[model samples]
Target: MMAFYFSRLVEIFPFFLRGLWMTTKVAFCSLIICTLIGFILGMLRSSNIVFLKRLIGTYVAFARGTPFVVQIFIVFFIFPEWGLQLEAFPAALLAMAIMGSAFICEIVAGGINAVHNGQWEAASSSGLTKLQQLRLVIIPQAMKVIVPPLVGQYVLLIKDTSVVSVIGVMELTRVGWVTVVRIPEGLMVFALVGILYFSISYPLILLSNYLERRMAI
Candidate 1:
């Protein structure tokens, strides 16, 4: 039975393979972009600057609270009147970055907060500048706490590549949908999609567990 299924999959293999490649590209690109955005927003939110914190807080709040689909629509359609126009792929990528970044930023801030205050006080007493304290002391310890969440965020970002395909970005899920339209094997196609997502995420989950153990958190 499995052989027969593999034969059928082989028949439709190119479409799925193309889809897989697109998924990889989208996920990898978006992950890198989201990482930068997340780190910046995370740092800004933790900044001692008052107004900057509130502004960053509002952005994070809206990104976190709203539905991702709405964000995609707003950026792709509604923002056009303001003379900002992005093609489907860039728009989808932006949406993914924005949504994922907000979550990542929160994860970072949470990790930072988890560090004991005494560490900061001790660093300050040692005459360390804020940048020096962060670079030398707080960041290293916060990093251990942050890894599990950041890894989980990366997995989530990869999973999110599917949602962007809804806007016709021709990534994995979009390719799957197109193939299913031709083949009319919705269950098989979707099942394969689930398998692909699981294959990537499960390994990350294991790695996260290992890091958590090593960090002793």
Candidate 2:
């Protein structure tokens, strides 16, 4: 039975590949959008401006406090009542961006805050504007603290793509679930799903570890 199921899976491999491609596209696009928004919000959160800090803090808090599945439901189901319509893919990406940016925002904020006050003073003493100080001196230093965890966060985000399958995005997890119904081999179907996810995430795991070691030294 296992051999038969395996053969069945192999025959349908291209379908799985299509699902994997969809997952990759969503993850990659979300990562880019999250990184940009997170960095900007992080910088603002780390700044002396009280209002901006509080505003972004509220957003991060709300995002972190909620369950991702709930967030996805809200985006997909609730938004249309508010006259904002979105297809499955865009809704999934929006959910990913919102959730990912909040976490990444915290990471970036923590990294910036980790840099010493002395570094800031030194840059200011050199007559560099605040923007120049962050650009030339601070962010460069913060990246060392940021990169390792950022990579790890990326792995989490990739795995989180599975949750987006709940919205009918036809991603890898959804594909596996659909296949299991047809193949009647839950273990085999999902095991292939696990392998595919690992194939995508394991390299990032290694890179995260490498960055940790490199940054520590």
By TM-score, who's the top model here?
Answer: 2
lDDT of each residue in 1-217, candidate 2, tens digit only: 8898889999999999999999999999999999999999999999999999999999999999999999999999999999989999999999999999999999999999999999999999999999999999999999999999999999999999999999999999999989988999998888899999999999999999999999999
Q: Cα RMSD (Å) per model?
A: 2.2, 0.9
lDDT for model 2: 0.96
Query: What is candidate 1's lDDT per residue for 62-101, written digit by digit as tens?
Result: 9989988889889888878898899998888889888888
Pairs that collide in candidate 1 are: none
Distance from true location, Cα of 74 in model 2, Å: 1.0
lDDT for predicted candidate 1 compared with the true structure: 0.83
> All models: lDDT?
0.83, 0.96
